[model samples]
Target: MPAALEESAKPVIIGRSSSHFTRVTRIFAAELHVDYSFRVVRDLMSSNPEDYGGNPALKIPSLQTPRGVWFGSLNVCRELWRRSSPRPRVVWPEDHDEPLLANAQELVLQAMSTEVSLIMGKLGGTGDSAHHTKMRQSLINMMAWLEDNATSVLAALPQPRDLSYLEVTLFCLVSHLEFRDVLPTAPYPELNKFCQQFAARASIGETTFGFDT
Candidate 1:
């Protein structure tokens, strides 16, 4: 059993610490100085849908806030932002007009993350060549684009924001790639450096990587 949430204040974050999505929520909670109870759901192989009623998708990191239950990692983070007094300002420029770039970045992050997950799953038990090939090509393309454009793209971002959802999600994806040895780090030096700096954050440190039991 996990520790109970405080009655006076604080929200309950129910999820395993090992999930990347859950870690993102934990990092956000840590940044906001929000106390949360982490309900560990070890090994998805043994976890049932009933164990995650708060998130119908059966995803980890479902948050039970004072206002209501929040599903999805980013959704939970948004709720955390809302709950915080003098809410932490947006970490990315809200007025940016680079919709194409932003969308591309998000798509790449999602693709890379999905690739990592699929590959890891394959290594753990199942194996599929077509899936591996598709993920490999998608990741390769994304890395090529980032290697050729990351500096300029990042330079155009609004300063003082520190980080964005794109940045953090990308960072998590890249870190997972390395942690699982899914790909060689040499292919993405710039991304490697960005993740290194991002990982140095106190919030990130609190949510360091570990395999789910």
Candidate 2:
């Protein structure tokens, strides 16, 4: 490819606009100031890896960089941070030594994955199956625990941090539940409050989720 073509490539983010996992990377991109092109994954049901930026997992939010393609949201975010100059202080999951913070990170990711499964099942016309019902119950249980523990978990996190993956993922997950009508967020006041505060960030504002047309 020509030099101009290569520079014009920037970094291509392959994912759907409405996807929470995708939004996480998009927000990270905005925060890190990494200019990139957005390539929407038109069909989530497609089995073709090409549709998902050559992700063998057929997942979205993959980042295509000159260095290589990143497979998932966290990998993409880490690469973005690596490329960032005067990098911000990012608190990774390993930084959370305490049980509260570590557990919070784990549950937030679990909730996001559960949400994905539930949404995919719905889209696949399997929403009414027994497994789907169990998944919904699991999600509800997780949310309840999160609502009770959110404050303590946040308090345990390190102070004076620029960003933490846990916070970003939690914000995306809670806001997404309401966005997709998977569940009403009103019941989880603590999570709602956190979402309201997190939503004020410029990065979060820029990456508001919306289904691809």
Candidate 3:
């Protein structure tokens, strides 16, 4: 390829706009100021890996780069940060040594995963199944815990940080619950307040959730 063509090339983010997991990476890309193209995964049910940017897990938000495809939201965000200049201060999961912060991160992710499972179950026509019922209860429990502790968990974080995975995931999870109509967020006042504050960022405005055709 010519130098111009090579310069024009950029990493591709494979995922849907409505997906919370994908939104997390998109927000990271925007905040990191890393330029990348968005490639929507049109069919979530597609068995072909190519539809998900060669992700064997058939998941979205994979990063397709010159080096290789990075799977999962965290991997893609790290890669995007690596490609950014004057990298911002990022707080990773390992930084949380205490149970409050650590467990908050755990439950945020667990709730997100549980939401995904519930959506997939609905699509799979496994409505009201035993596992699905249990997942719903688990999700509710996790959200309750998060709502009660969100303020303190956030307050306890180390100061002067550009971003943290926990915050991003929590924002996405809370916003997504409302977006997907999986649950009424009016009940989660603390989480809603956090979302309102987080939504003020430019990245959040740029990555509003919506289903893609």
Candidate 4:
């Protein structure tokens, strides 16, 4: 994490600063003390694949690295973990063998994806469309489920661990809802409390969501 070392031959992280998926990988990189140069993808609606670092899926978070392009936040985060010396103990999605843990991970990811669809729909001027309405309901259902189960989910996470993908993704999802103004989260007291506690991390502060410019 030395200043000189951080500036040396860093990988390029291609994504918009406001993306939740992008923030997820950035948080992981920070936690692992991995340095990388950020390349802003200025246009989210760009049809060209090159606009998103040659991602065929046109996703925001594609990591251009020495090894090759790693598409998606999960792959990028895994690669970041692999590159870190003295790697910290991380609880990945695969480690959630129990029903409670597995369900939490599933709901968190699903909710994130749903939130993205809703945002895109609104930006595309389809906010009043039937599918958009369904997506809103889906997000509502998922949030209600997560909020009601937050206490048990937090208590169930494995202790003495450096970090868990579930927790990080959950934090990003909740925080992004507020950041993007996609949903009003005031009703979810449990989730709000969790976010309040998690926001104390330096990584969280460093990766605060905002427009690139």
Clashing pairs in 3: none
lDDT of each: 0.68, 0.89, 0.91, 0.91
TM-score of each: 0.81, 0.94, 0.95, 0.94
Clashing pairs in 4: none
What ranges in model 3 sit over 4 Å off? 1-8
- Provide the lowest-lDDT 10-residue window in model 4: 1-10
Which ranges of candidate 4 are over 4 A from the true structure? 1-8
Residues 1-213 of candidate 2 have per-residue lDDT tens digits of 876676446898999889999999898888888888999999888999999989999887899987679999999999888877779998888898888888888888888999999988998899999999999999999999899998888777788888889989999999999899898999999999998998899998899989789
* Deviation from native of the Cα of residue 144 in model 2, angstroms: 0.7
Count of clashing residue pairs in every prediction? 0, 0, 0, 0
Tens digit per residue, CA lDDT, model 3, 1-213? 776565446989999999999999999999999899999888888999999989999888799987789999999999988888889998888899999999999998889999999988998999689999999999999999999998899999887899999999999999899788788899999999998998899999998999887
Question: Per-residue CA lDDT of candidate 1, range 8-43, in tens?
Answer: 356777776556677777878777777677777765
Q: Provide the lowest-lDDT 10-residue window in model 2.
A: 1-10
Better of 2 and 4 by lDDT: 4
TM-score of model number 4: 0.94
